[model samples]
Target: MSQTGYQSFEELIVWKKARELKNELFQLGKAFPPEEKYRLTDQLIRSSRSINAQIAEGHGKRTNKDKIKYCTQARGSISETINHLIDAFDCGYISTEQLKRYRIRFDELEKILSGYIKYLRSLPGD
Candidate 1:
């Protein structure tokens, strides 16, 4: 079991939210121009997916410090994903409204992820 009382990262609300965001981003990437197949689209999908993967990896760690480290990495991935989203907007792949919507979702995910990290920190272990 995880320090947060969850049996698996899949059971964590933060991970679920990240998964949802990742899925949505994957769908959005499918709409990108063919020429961007190896550029923006690839980077966007990779970073968005990394958020959930990092959370899952963190949850599996044996130490609180390791867990916190991975969660921090996940947080960084969130920022990276947002940067890619902005790039998509600047390149006209997505509209202002689309970018705004994604920003809201990313913001919510970041808050939840931060809370999870705080909870992990409160646990009585290294």
Candidate 2:
């Protein structure tokens, strides 16, 4: 979509991707053992959801600095989610195939976020 068309967070590619990733993670989380319902499951869910939450929150911040800060936090959340995925793999909660696919998703989200951050930084009036 064009920048002019971006009226809300829903119009953002990064936000959309993060939302999709969250859904995919939710589905995959279902396969984890029941014992992790409150542990790993919750952690994965929260981190994945935070990706988009940060973006939306950042967009609404009062200043560019605050917005950038929130965007950076969102980027960190993606990394955190990746670590959680690694832990899930180490614990045998997810298969190698699932881990690989999920890692790719996170990688894409990170790239989009990075680009968005760059765009934000390039804007005038810092």
lDDT of 2 by residue, 78-107 (tens): 999999899899999888998899888889
Model 1 alpha-carbon miss at residue 6, Å:
5.0
For model 1 the TM-score comes to 0.94
Candidate 1 error regions (>4 Å): 1-6
For residues 56-106, write the lDDT of model 1, one tens digit per residue.
999999999999999999999999999999999999999999999999999
* C-alpha lDDT of candidate 1 relative to the true structure: 0.95
lDDT of 1 at 88: 98
- Candidates in order, TM-scores: namely 0.94, 0.92
Model 2: which ten-residue window has the lowest total lDDT? 1-10
RMSD each, Å: 2.3, 1.9
Candidate 2 off by > 4 Å: 1-6
Q: What local lDDT does model 1 show for residue 101?
A: 96
| Model 1 clashes, total count | 0
